[model samples]
Target: MAPAPRAQPSPVAVAADVSSAPVSTGCGNGGPTTHRGLAAATAASRTMYWPLLRNAECRHGLPAGLLDALVFQESRYRPLVVSRAGAGGLAQLMPRTAGDLGVINRFDAVANLDGGARYLRSMLDRYRSVPLALAAYNAGRGAVDRWGGLPLNRETPDYVRKVLTFFNEDA
Candidate 1:
């Protein structure tokens, strides 16, 4: 009888094995190194403008991470983005809403974030829940009030879910 043929590794298997291996940073100065440190550094770098975020949070008594997550979800932290509906900046505030929030410069990153955070906090207070506040934030407070909290619309429900998911994950 012929000897059994040896099994050959599949390309997918080989690729997966290689990908499972730890990547080397190749930093010659290696004073200290850790995956946790690298992850922390990456997260920190993403929030290098944290002082501005913190200021907004402090001024409005809202959680900084929540504000950051909302801004990221709304505009990906872009200070100059405008929605077709006339929402502007990092928090995507409407011009009238920005005026109501006393945001002097709706296009300014700090001012926009501050106004958005304050507005969200007020909505939270009004609705008494994050999900409801998120729904109001996405859909309008009138819609939420009409529904006695979160709107019954599918789009608003999904938007609230996404915002809360991001907020929880980031926190």
Candidate 2:
């Protein structure tokens, strides 16, 4: 007899884990609830991600807050997350991209932070602006290059806005 096939998880289920699975804050409100399909950047998460982020910043020539905000937007400091689009871990790195960055294990905090910071830094250096860099990070470089700036895609603008708000660049 042939082995039975396992059912694949629905996108909705994967997305719930990606954006809404609460990390233990050990505080009130159970680690802050997700609002608008994005996790809240709680103080607990900042404390957790700070050490790895700081080290990535120093080694990658990126600012700590920039990486933090991106992580806040990407995974909310959740290490085991896997996105509906198949991106994985804290940085939401796709497997191929992670491999290219020498990130053999996306769930590994230090490796993910370093790879993510390096990727973000390269995007920033290439685009020379926060919006463009963020758009590239979210929508890929080809999209930005074709659009000649931030693409008019629905999700990319909101993504940039969220990261900017967390980075305090929205002012």
- Best model number under lDDT: 2
Error of 1 at 4 (Å): 75
Show pairs that collide, candidate 2: none
TM-score of predicted structure 2: 0.73
Every model's TM-score:
0.69, 0.73
State residue 164's C-alpha deviation in candidate 2, in Å: 0.5
Q: Tens-digit lDDT track for model 1 on 1-171? A: 875333233221122221222222221222221222235644443355456765676666664356766776677666788998899988899998999999989888878878998898888677555666776788888876666655656577666666655655643
Model 2 regions more than 4 Å off: 1-42, 169-171
lDDT of 1 at 83: 92
